[model samples]
Target: MSLAVGAVSSSKNMGFDESKDSEEKSHVSESSKNLPPPSPTPTEEALREGEKYNRQMSETSLYATEEEEDDEERKIELGPQCTLKEQLEKDKDDESLRRWKEQLLGSVDLNSVGETLEPDVKILSLSILSPDRPELLLRIPEAGNPKGLWFTLKEGSRYSLKFSFKVSNNIVSGLKYTNTVWKTGVKVDSTKEMLGTFSPQAEPYTHEMPEETTPSGIFARGSYSAKTKFVDDDNQSYLSINYTFDIKKDWPSTS
Candidate 1:
């Protein structure tokens, strides 16, 4: 009886050991199947980095080429220079054309009855003259010189404003004169007068300034412009001119 019991106990211990070994082997196989892929080699990582750098360089080079092409497209090449003689001839032709137009317009008959009215009136001259000082007349300078209409106005003094016009058609119009001062502030003085039916055969009309007090604050030593407008019967402006002048606190000493 004792020997049979010993044999049975030995068999049971052996069976338990075999079962544990099989369970451990199955667990190891499952763990290996669930594991992530191995990391890339250093060489492979370097090759990928090199490829990315090459792609960036290629893109930058292509962009630079496109910008260069655009710059070339926008660059303008100047034409051949004209000869001095050619330029002079061109200027002469322009002057002749201008004179022809003036003469043709001047000869037109404007006083004929039932003739259509035209805004062909021309301002012959416009000036602000000082009777006391003949040299102080405001004059329009020719172009390419120091071009500006300038006058030196003395405080508390009066000036004469004159303007003349020539018409090529029978048009009833009026003169609207305006004097303004503007800098840090603005002030305006205006006057209007009727001019009856004007014709080319009529003499140029002239007017002088009326007696009036100059605005007090206008004599501040700065720059200002005086403007005049020629308006038709309906108050529509057809011609305008402006003059710029400076104001002085005191007149220059003659000595």
Candidate 2:
């Protein structure tokens, strides 16, 4: 009986040991399957994923900012809106045309038909050359020799003279006011003479043509006046500008 009881106790202990070992092994296998890979830690994977997302977001934001900057640098104007350079160029063109119109309108310092008027040494000499058109080459004083307008007007005598003038300003309507009379002699009475003067009928200025190397200039008559002589060399001559005149640009520069 003792022996049999000892044997039964040993057998029970062995079975318990085997069952415990099997339970331990099964628990280890289940735990290992639930866990992730060992080489790449779970924390490292989370960190790497976060870094990749941040890099993609940064790249997208950088591209968007660059596009916005490019849009800001360039501006578009659809219609009528002029830029600064364009406005400046237009103003320059207008100023140039105004000066041309003034020059082409002629001056008020000239005498009537077949008369002579004194020339101002200061303002009259400003015109370097007539507004790029057919200009009558006036004889300039060569260093020492100076020839001026020398004409004697007879009392009660009516005459008409033609001269080549320049049109610097294009304002043809106000041609009379723009003109300046520099000199005038003593006035004489011509009450008995039936006088008739041929004023400027149209503008003497021409347009720019294709064959024209330089820009074609304009010219016009401003006014007209009569002369009444009182003295021999001091005869009074009437002077005026003819606003209506003709223009011819098919000519070359004389100077």
Candidate with best TM-score: 1
lDDT by residue (tens digit), candidate 1, 1-255:
999999989988777577787999999999999999899777988999999999999988774332363355346343443332232235455878657544533443423423433445665665656544554434443322224735566665667667777664444434344444554445444454555545354567666666443434544566666555566544445565566666676555545
TM-score, predicted candidate 1 vs. hidden true structure: 0.44
- Backbone clashes, candidate 1: 0
Q: For residue 232, what is the lDDT in candidate 2?
A: 11
**Alpha carbon deviation, residue 159, candidate 1 (Å):** 1.5
The runs of at least 3 residues in candidate 2 whose Cα sits more than 4 Å from the true structure, single-residue gaps closed, are: 1-149, 154-156, 168-173, 177-255
TM-score of each: 0.44, 0.16
lDDT of 1: 0.55
Assess candidate 2 and give its lDDT.
0.33
Write candidate 2's Cα lDDT for 1-255 as tens digits. Answer: 999999979988777677787999999999999887779546988999999999999988764332363354334222443322232235455877657534543343222211212211111221112233332433323233223332222222222222232322111121111121212222211221212211221334222211212212332211113321111111112222221111233332335
How accurate locally is residue 124 in candidate 2, as Cα lDDT from 0 to 100? 21
